[model samples]
Target: MRGIQLQLSQTQKVRLQKALEQLESLSSKVNSDASVTIADSIPVNHEDGVLKGHGTTDLNGEVVATLCGVVERVNKLVYVRSLRSRYKPEVGDIVIGRVVEVAQKRWRLDINYSQNAYLMLSAMNMPDGVQRRRTALDELNMRCIFEEMDVICAEVRGFQHDGLHLQARSQKYGKLSTGQLLTVPPYLVKRQKQHFHHLEQYGIDLIIGCNGFIWVGEHVEARDDMVEDQVNQTDPQVLIPNKDSVSFEEQEKNYTALETRKYICRAANAVRVLSSLGFIITLEIIKGVFELSLSSNLDIHDMLGSEFCVLVAEKEAERRSSNKKKR
Candidate 1:
């Protein structure tokens, strides 16, 4: 398939063209040698092929991909290229992100994208027996439920000017404290979206996002070394679910929960090891580093899980900086 670009309507085109022309004139004066270029930056498969913006010019006349989209007169700055696809969470998409900042009405998540996402108190499912609307007390109690670095499974509610908003309507979607956080480059993470699973052998659960933010955790308190033992066993007996005792739906849900837990835990372990090594890792990096195959013991979650530990690394760096200050 051909590479995709964002599409734009005629009105958007006219607006972009005018901006480009103005930017070109400005560029000529700003840097006599540098060229201000704008090509058809829309994606082929993008239904809304909007010309979002242009790129940036360095002092040495080299060009870089634009980080922010254009808003015409706001920046009057010549856009050099359209923003690269960063895979921020969208409405209705399931994602996993680490809680970074906790505020009055929302929690901030670094979703491995351009913008930090917001998880609002209003978006959360209220208590089972509560008859009234969520109160400030509810928010405070909920605040205690999540601390910095908690991994959460949530659905993107929508995007606002502030950031991407997330909702956790189910018990499955809240307070993921016992897990390792993984961070990968956004693009490769998107490619492995369909393969999320939890392996019974691995005793882990995995939550994957297009932005490369993965959350991994143990399904139960199992030893790390026991993982290999369980996965290597050929007992087809253990793999089969008990069909006689439960309804198909119940069985299916149980199997899914088990699988999700296993995948997340295994990925968390893998990510923890790699992130400790101080590499700016991606899903591709993990796949390459581990030398894994598609059909191997590792799953899509394992690859993206290699990018884990941004928060821990940041904290360590801060600690060192503080220690150095004391010296």
Candidate 2:
């Protein structure tokens, strides 16, 4: 276990050490014998026709691991699940990434993968919500839609000859604003059916990217651009908007409530604490930590202190113990 560097008193150090030791003991009970290092031979029954899977290769008829990870066996099939590795893009996985480059009709993003993922203009829905073919005008105005360093949420389309591809066809999939982007170990984030979460109480959106790029931002309602465009086109008053109306609209767009910002920070801090403890990042776990902080009346900054880290470790150890008992 890696200890976080912090200026701690003797009591705090002892408490943290105890909590971490308890956590480690619980983890050892589950994965002690299953863990493997590179070049380690994986014992298997050859009489059952054992098949070698990812991270394992046949070395003179012996199954040897190519990576350091935990060995997982699903019946006869076995593979090593790396503890820390780059994001492996799969079709239909949701990912949050920053726009690194805007080329001719496509955008390149660094998704913490071995290679940059590509988001082609033709693969995504346009701002107008039209299904027409992309034109030269659209290609020229690509930067206006997504410039350099703009954070975006997209779905993995698949791998092509060029590289990994992404698509943003839904309103929920687009540029993220007014939030903090946190990068954690990719293995900490597991794939789930629902990655996009709107905390109505906090008035924020939590996007858990499978790629370990999490976005915690102010929640924006999904709007149908096609319907909105039709309404504006038919309404003569909307076409010739008054100055007062335009100013109010701009103000509404630019303003972020102070309370919302506070919640965003609180939520972000919860993630930081969880990541620092090397806990699995999940929505339920995040909500539990956030609510615990609120109940304890801990300031956002104080959540990063040694006491909170110890508290989290103890709570996690207790939670896992109870869960194992139930099982």
Candidate 3:
């Protein structure tokens, strides 16, 4: 759905069509009857008892899907996995979000979820790496840390009385900078062990947030609170600078390096291609495409071209096939 809006030659169109067909073929073989639309009755072994799970319901003793997507069964439980929907945060899932509002004691973030997520002041670790309680002065300085429209990375911390709550207790989970934020459909991002990656080769960082907000930019070292002894503790007064006094020189420091910026664009375009093809996103696949572009000497700007896209599709088909054979 991403680059297809561009003008295409007949040959390019044909290649894209073929690649899409191949993807459908592979998906169908995995579970021909597993894909279903809304209100479709799920096929089941009738002799045994069954339990309806999320995205499913019983209608006259028949199991039916309430959503449109693949059906999965685990033991006696059956459920539908929606292919397109707002982000549903699981506790502990890493999410990248934007500051939407600065409320009384918390910051509201738009995390692509059904509701805006809350980041209470009490849930955060002090910038000075102190373990003491957050004082009223700390609450007053919240805007200095994260203002409206600023991007942030955080962890899901279950629901509070008002809405979904997020936490940034660790160093890595905090404000994001020098990055390009891109949004893909939520279904394409699958949860895994790690969501943060530092691409040392390209000097870039990639955070594939579970809510589908991706950050591509120059890598920054995750701040270590344990190393506070090496440097003097930052004075609260100095830490909370007046917004009006912020200088141009300080802001210029946030600008990324030329080479790192190029890498960021290339990586972002790679993600665009994968999302357009509806492929499950993973580090291996993403890195494969990045290396493919570099090895072929393809210009960074040309990575999103129709010809390059077709090449990527063909390579992906071959790669998945090889993986299956190994398995």
If scored against the real structure, what TM-score would every candidate get? 0.45, 0.86, 0.87
Q: Give lDDT per model, in order.
A: 0.51, 0.86, 0.83
**Order of quality (TM-score):** 3, 2, 1
For candidate 1, lDDT tens digit of each residue in 199-285? 455556555665667766656431222111222333444442322456777556545455555555555555544444333334434
Candidate 3 whole-model C-alpha lDDT, 0 to 1? 0.83
Clash count for each candidate, listed in order shown: 34, 0, 0
lDDT of 1: 0.51
Query: What is residue 297's positional error in candidate 2, in angstroms?
Result: 1.2
Q: Which candidate number would show the highest lDDT if scored against the true structure?
A: 2
Best TM-score goes to which candidate? 3
Better of 1 and 2 by TM-score: 2
Best to worst by lDDT, what's the order? 2, 3, 1
lDDT by residue for model 2 (1-327), tens: 344777778987788778878878988888889999999999999999887889999999899999999999998898998888778889999999999999979999989899999999998887787688887666756766777898999999999999999999888888888899999889889999999999999999999999999999999887533212322243333332332344667688769999999999999999988988889999999998999899999988999988888888778888888888999
Per-candidate RMSD vs. true structure? 19.5, 4.3, 3.5
lDDT of candidate 3 at residue 174, scale 0 to 100 = 87
